[model samples]
Target: MLFTYPIAATADNWVSTTLLELLKNAVEYLQNAQEPDGFQESVPEEYQAEFARGTKFPDLYAAFVDQCRLLNDQQRDLVLKALAGQNGFPGLFAANTPCPNITVTLQAVNQATRSLFEYAFGKLSDLKTPGSVDTVRARYHQLVHSHIASGCCPFCGLEILEAPDPDLVDPDLDHYLAISKYPFAGANLRNLTAMGTTCNRSYKGAKDILLNELNQKVDCIDPYGDQLITISLAGTVLLPGGGQGPAWVLSFDPDALSQNWRRIFKLETRLQANVLEKQYQTWLESCVKYAQKNGIDISLKEGAIEAVRKFRDTCEYETFPAIARLKTNFFELVEAELNDPQDGDRMHNFVAAVQAA
Candidate 1:
């Protein structure tokens, strides 16, 4: 996935205003209701009665208060820091200190915040309407769209259209950390990413990218961080019993988190023959056309090399990355053939076919 640009801090940004406001409100509203032991039993009579009524508001408030009471000053600050987009609290556990119950507090906060956010901004389901405005969601959407020049889903590298009609929905805002599993991160702006509907819903539903085979928690690459996992086209291989001639495969560096991302997202499998062939064909046609127009011999190799480099550079910003990487790998293979005397005929036949097509 392409790295997402970090959201700049501004006075009017949602994190500085809406999120902080909600958090402060939550703390204040629940303050009087919180007992020394962090239970509602010793609270005022009205609050006790409200809790006894079994309403969600009182329950959520109690959970928030209880979690806060359990945390030390430092831990609480960590949560605040995370909320402010300065750090990632849950990801901290992947490193040195393990805060197991932090998730509990975060979950409570997420549940309460979602209810409060929806109350203020209207229901999330109704966001498709042109008139509907959720400040938080809107800001996140704008941040993503503005940052990603390719205008494609970072995960799948598929084109994400900005509909001319305001009523039409854009890409889905995927919670990088699933809200169901990591509720505390639910409202964290850094955890939200804009992705295509298929990548967000179909392939990556509720799966934890932060865990390993042993179910132990590990840190997933933060798409907004300075450090990002790089992806490259590994090689092309012929399927065992295939109608398609060859398919390109992808490979990542030795980083475990990157590997986990590939496995969880099924990157290699998703970009198989059917998905990449069109892109490969396009690259080939472009190269052939360039050679013919320039009156350059396709067999001389310089035109082919130059064409591939130009296409790869342009694809880096203009096309879907999966297709772009496919082009890179395809040209590399062609270059390898050109360099080998025995493979010259194979390369010539390939170029001839591309020209004919």
Candidate 2:
């Protein structure tokens, strides 16, 4: 993202305005800054408008107006910075591309709406009994969500059909605040994802845990948040023998991270098939030599080929650590080959060197 100028402050005097009006103004500005090709430009002006409507104002109307003013300035600065286009936005909240601006805008709107509702409800809660706090909180939550169904899901990154699924029931809104602290992701519509209620309970707030296990800082990929394509199935694996089976691996692409050694693993598939073919050819040559030296009565080549085939065909995720260690050792051996100067034969100069000697 880029910025042409800093966000300028607004005047102290404020006016009364409805939340609808605030949103209307924000939409208009966004529409104006939108490119002909449909890409949006950052505009901090909307934030200024929101800040002008802060709760400290004398009455509800005055507060909303001031909040809008702050929102206006903030939105304008965001626009200018985003337009400069230097800082690449993270590809979260969508499958293949970044929707930073869209998500940010939604977050802004969500936050503003939440603040307004909280102010209204918190004031009411202050007059009630202590036991009613939970009830009031629930009502406030309901009120917040009342405006949510009208929104869109920011988590899935793209529009999803309103179909009932166990994964999507009682969807809770989520936002990828690691990128931008926008509230747009908190609405059930924008952040709603369907999961079994039980799964949701288990996976709720597991983002931090997953991050730690990953051992690297990678952005989440959501239609509106982050991109995480691979998930561990260590706990999901089950067997009929009352014990866990081998760990199963799942990914949008099985071949993903073939180059990233840190997350690489092994399984029986086409790549392994190819590797097996090469390994068996080498084993065939090795076995032939071994039989010649020992004068073996049996067909050692056949046995060696069979062993290689079995190793390749039955390779599973559990065997990855050992296989990968071997791979690493082989890599080191190759590095040694390249670094050594004693092996003229290895560099294809043996014919001339032998004649000269």
Candidate 3:
């Protein structure tokens, strides 16, 4: 991730809490098989009518109830272990860590445990209760606008996250934890975050942060966490024997996080293709113009070096029309190229081009 997402009073665990409460009720409903009553009351109040047997909406919980009655002793135990276990979906997502994944599968009870939460997760929109997805989204809008950089994705500052408004379409709430492959965090606000369309769907789609493709255990990052990772340009790598064009090198700090992040989102490759490769020379031109406007003569290598550093300092925060980290690092690259005598005045000639324009 590029920067940490701010968890405000707005980004509550309302959806998550509601899901867990339903799961808890499910655990008890299965345990007291002596009488299979009170199953209707276990459902969230807003969607209770829908869950009732002869309702306009389908009785989604009816199958679960029937399955619970037919549970063998071992299956009943599986329900308890999965829903009631300390390290179950509730606990693992509550902490939002990748290690110590919930080992108990919901299939332990032939998916009798799955219906309750999944059904309720869908109904969070109709919830008049304070915890509706609408209430959360409204709050998220406020929190995002106030706390995070405007139109910036906390995952990667490169993409644009449209400013959400009530009348217009909403942003995509990306699940930090892969709820599709792993169970539990589907509706949890803790697991949810707003990301760019490309970031959410294209790159970070359903890739389990907790487990790699080989099913190896990996570390996870909290979507609403405070830990910030650094994306820096280490330097440029030139092609051997010289005519193919220089290759860019990006460095991400706190290597462990970088490895998993890069693996999940293909962060380095995306930045190289989308931002660096396409924008490098254009960005250099902007930097030159910015420095020239500020009365710094960028024609000289010394002046160009000063321009790079000064422009970098201005990009410390992600503001409109500029990716803070990208500009900062690109300038760092410019400064590096300015200092390197081997490139035969690569950036110098680039600066000369800007001056001519």
Candidate 4:
């Protein structure tokens, strides 16, 4: 996938200033709700009484607030560091800091944070009101549609343009670190990212991106970081039973994290869908049409290579980048065949047959 710009740097602009103010207010509210022995009283009376009643988990709220209060300045800084997409904080917190002895589960803290996040941002319907604060979901939708993604899902490079509704059009925000697992980072800006709903809800549901099998934090490529993932077509083979010309196998460099990313998103399998194959076939047909219109004889090796190169270059900035990369790599394979003296004649004949078809 193409690299993503830093989200933390840009997130502040989209998030309403009122939301930050509300967060500070919520913190104060939590602090006031706590008693001397780390138990909470009922919530403030200003909120709707029924809503306030639901929030009154005295011990759980107290434990969550106490955990935050117990953090030293350095540890607090680490919290901010994790929010900025840096590594080391998760592991440090898990290993060094022990949860206080209270009836609070980490899941409770996560749920509380999520509730606070929603309250501060307001509801989705509230976002349409003139001066109401923008919800986190709304801000993330804006970030995805206007900045990171356009006509398709950025993570899978699939054209998800079937719906016209803004909510349906916009991709889902997958918490890169599962919010259920990392409660402290639930509202951290950098942890949120736009992904296809299928990838987020179906394939990568609640999976931990930061932690390893040993439960130690291992660094994965943050989509918001400067690192770029390169997807290429590894090879193609004609399958005896398939109707299509050949099945292309895609590969990625920097395989460690890239492979993990692929597995998490099910990218290879997603890209191999019948619709995508049809799209690829259509793209190939366009190249042949262009060659014919320009009076270029693609029956020759050099001519076929030139036509493929032109098509590949044209697709570089298109909406579906995965297709562009695949096409580029496919052309490179053709170029290799043309350069080999032994295979050159056979490759030329293959092109002639494709052109005639």
lDDT per residue as tens, model 1, 1-357? 555555541112332233344454445444445443333443344334422433343455445555656555565665555444322433552534342323455655455544533332322322222223544455556656777777777776765746324587866767676655545455455566667788878877888766665776666666666555566555655232245666555677646657667777777677764466545667678777776776766664565555545554555444676666656666666666655687655666666667777
Ranking by lDDT: 3, 1, 4, 2
Q: Which residue window of length 10 is worst by lDDT in model 3?
A: 93-102
C-alpha local distance difference test of each model = 0.55, 0.31, 0.61, 0.54
lDDT per residue, candidate 2, 1-357, as tens digits? 000101111011111122333344544454465312111122134334343334432243333333444455557555333322212323332223332343346354434444543453333322222324333223333433343342222221112223333354334332223223332222212232332222234333334211324444333323223232322222222121344322222223223322121222122332234333234334334433543454442233333333333333333222233232223332233223323465422422321222233
- Model 4: per-residue Cα lDDT over 1-357, one tens digit each: 455634643354222233323333434544555434322223233333323333433444454455556544554343333323322333332423332211133334345544444442333323332343554456555555555544566567654522335545545656676655444444445556666677678887887665545654444665666567887666665232345456677677776666556766777787777434666556667778888988887877788877766766776666566666666666666666656797766666665666778
**Residues 222-334, model 3: lDDT tens digits:** 55666568776676663223555557777777777557767778788877887777876677677878987999887787887788788878876647333567777666666
Candidate 1: where is the Cα deviation over 4 Å?
Answer: 9-134, 161-165, 235-244, 297-317
Alpha-carbon lDDT of model 3: 0.61
Error of 3 at 61 (Å): 3.1
What are the models' TM-scores? 0.67, 0.28, 0.79, 0.66
Number of the candidate with higher lDDT, 1 or 3: 3
Tally clashes: model 4.
0
